[model samples]
Target chain A: MSWVVENLDLIGRLTVEHLRQSALPIVLGLLLSIPAGWFAFRFRLTRGVVLTAVGLLYTIPSLALFALLPPLLGISFLSEVNLIVALTIYAVAIMTRFVADALSSVEPSVRQAADAVGYGTWRRFWQVDLPLAGPVVLAGLRVTAVSTISLCTVGILIGIDNLGYLFTNGYQRQIIPEILAGVVAVVVIALLVDWLLVLAGRALMPWTRKGA
Target chain B: MDLFADAIAWIFSPEAQSGSLPLSEAIWTHLAFTFVSVLIAAAVAVPAGWLVGHTGRGREAAVALSGAARAVPSFGLVLLLVLVFGVTHKVGASTTAFVLLAIPPILAGAYSGVEAVERRVVDGARAVGMTSRQVLGKVEIPLGLPLLIGGLRSATLQVVATVTLAGYVGSWGLGFYIVQGIQIRDFAQILGAALVIVVLAVVLDLLFALLERAVVPHGVAARRSAD
Candidate 1:
């Protein structure tokens, strides 16, 4: 308890850095994923190969990817670049599949109606296809956000500063209170992010709310 | 051509052979450590998940807790555990990390499965005066089994990656090879260890897929295509 009170500022700063590290990759990944997913949807084989590669990338341990980066890019903040690349690879794969599934779930008649109305492909995609797929896309985004938060913990192991550093430092010093503070801080951040995503999901797709 | 032959020759040479026992033995120990933790975690997670899904009480809290657990790195958690429980404790960090790993998937699977059970099927069961337990046992569990197993498969792979972290804490495992390979700059050993992890994860996922088919009614997996 005294540890928590004494180092409140440090802990707060750690949490903020952690959030910043996670936030950029997640937003950028999602933004990049949406269009790539849509493009892949139109080109089926390309989608399969890209997604499979991404899935394989997901299995590689984060530390290995970080370590491998130094040889290729001379390390530094470039390590974070590799981390984001690896994470984005995962996000794009998941979102691609999600987008495909959601699009398929859209009834055939809806597509027919869009065609009948003479809407061009791009306009129909933005207006009809995406809106119909909102719920699923939102769910995929939730998973991506959660995974990004989890993977950010690896940042500490690679000498990057984040809340995970607290865990490592506390453990090194055998200080239980400091370790608990880190764990609690991470848990709070995860929960808050999860709730925020859920609320955003609800706001975006009011239709899903009606059923539940 | 000579370089390739020399590399192969060295790989099968006497020194490598002498070092084989400790390396293979370490791998076996790591496997044991991982599987034991996974088994314990699965046992705890599965029951907790079923109960949470069955009763909606504290469902949000369970989800929140699982999310939080999933967010922290198992390696980091292991380090903390070693500090609190002492390094020699078998029930220390590895077990906690695996348990933490297991909770999220089981909870996600059980809750989503229960939630996804068709309303009509549930209503029909209730209309027949079926008890809640009967509805769950007879209808919901069977329906949810495939997706639940899918989640378990993913969680298992996660546990395997985590087991490699045990080396840092002085526990024996495949991580021994990975860390050693790094220290010695032996890319071949590093690749060998990583390949083992990949193969094991793929095999486990395939096995779970088969188990899902065997346990669930036929066509259920086909129906849950995205899962």
Candidate 2:
């Protein structure tokens, strides 16, 4: 506990940087995945190809991607920008499939009812499809957020230090308190991010609630 | 494009193909970690999972545990274990991390697979005076084999990906090539290592799919696909 107090200033900065790196990819992922997901759903050929490609992307280990991305993107290996690009690919890959699945999970009967009422594609998507997909999409976002926070720490090995610096340094110096602080801080961040997403989901889609 | 060609050349090069720490050795180390961790995970999860599914209890707890397990950053877990156990026990730390990563899928798969068996089938077995143990062995497990295999497939892939991180913690599997390549600015070696890992994953996935088909009761397999 005293260790935390002694290092409070360092912790404060790293925590902010950790959240910044993670948040950027998620926001970019959302922008990319929504339109791409919808396009895949709209086209039959893409349905199989896109989902399978994304699954293959997931199979590539995070460290492998961390190594592979720099040259592929023409960025320096140690640059945080390379880390961000890799993470964004991961975020988009995961979120895209979730976007498609969540949208498709809306009942066919409910969609048919909307169509019968003379609703056009644009308004009906907003009123019916997006709202119905809200819960599942939110759930995917929560997973993406937590996993990204954990994964972005891999950047430390490639020389782009974030919160993962704690783990690497603690291990090198054989410092128990710092290691404990690092592990506990990561768990806390994951929980806080998850909770914020849950709250955001509830706020956006009040229709998902049940009255008691 | 040249790096891709070089990676291909690197993979086939004599230095990588055969030496004290050859390509085969690294591949073996990787498979060893995966094989041991997964086998141990199955031994622990399968019986526990079967009992939980049989009683229809602890399913929620199982799901919650798996979710928490997944959220734990596996590389950090490796470091923690190494810190507690010391660097000399890198194998233990890496193996333990792989086991933790492997358990969720197997547990979830086994439980869901057993639960997925139709109640009528089990009841019919019971009506024939088969004991609960016999019913599980004969009816539920066979029916559940499909999902059990599915769980193993997922568990294997996760463990395979994670074993790469084992090298970071000092266990030097195929990930050695990637990490060392990065430090030395050897792009081909990094790509070579990545290519090997990807091929390893694809082969295992294909093997699991074949195993699932072979084990699943034919009619049940058909019904599942129909769904």
Best by DockQ: 2
Root-mean-square deviation of every model: 4.4, 2.5
The residue-by-residue lDDT of candidate 2 on A1-212, one tens digit each, is: 78779998887788888888889998888788887777667688988888877777777777778767765777887788988998888888889988998888889999999999999999998899888988888888887887788888888878876788888888788776777777678778978888988888888788777742
lDDT of 1 by residue, B35-141 (tens): 77667766777667776777777789877766566667576677777777776684565677776776687678777677678889889999999999999898888
Every model's TM-score? 0.81, 0.91
Model 1, range A5-98, lDDT digits (tens) per residue?
Answer: 9999999898888888888877877787777667666688877776666565666555455544444455442356666665666666666677
Name the runs in model 2 displaced over 4 angstroms: A39-44, B18-20, B117-131, B224-227
Candidate 1, clashing residue pairs? none
The DockQ score of candidate 2 comes to 0.54
**In order of the candidates, what TM-score does chain B achieve?**
0.83, 0.93
User: Could you give the fnat of all candidates in order?
Assistant: 0.34, 0.36
Docking class of 1: acceptable
For all candidates, the clash counts are 0, 0
Q: Enumerate the candidates' DockQ scores in order.
A: 0.35, 0.54
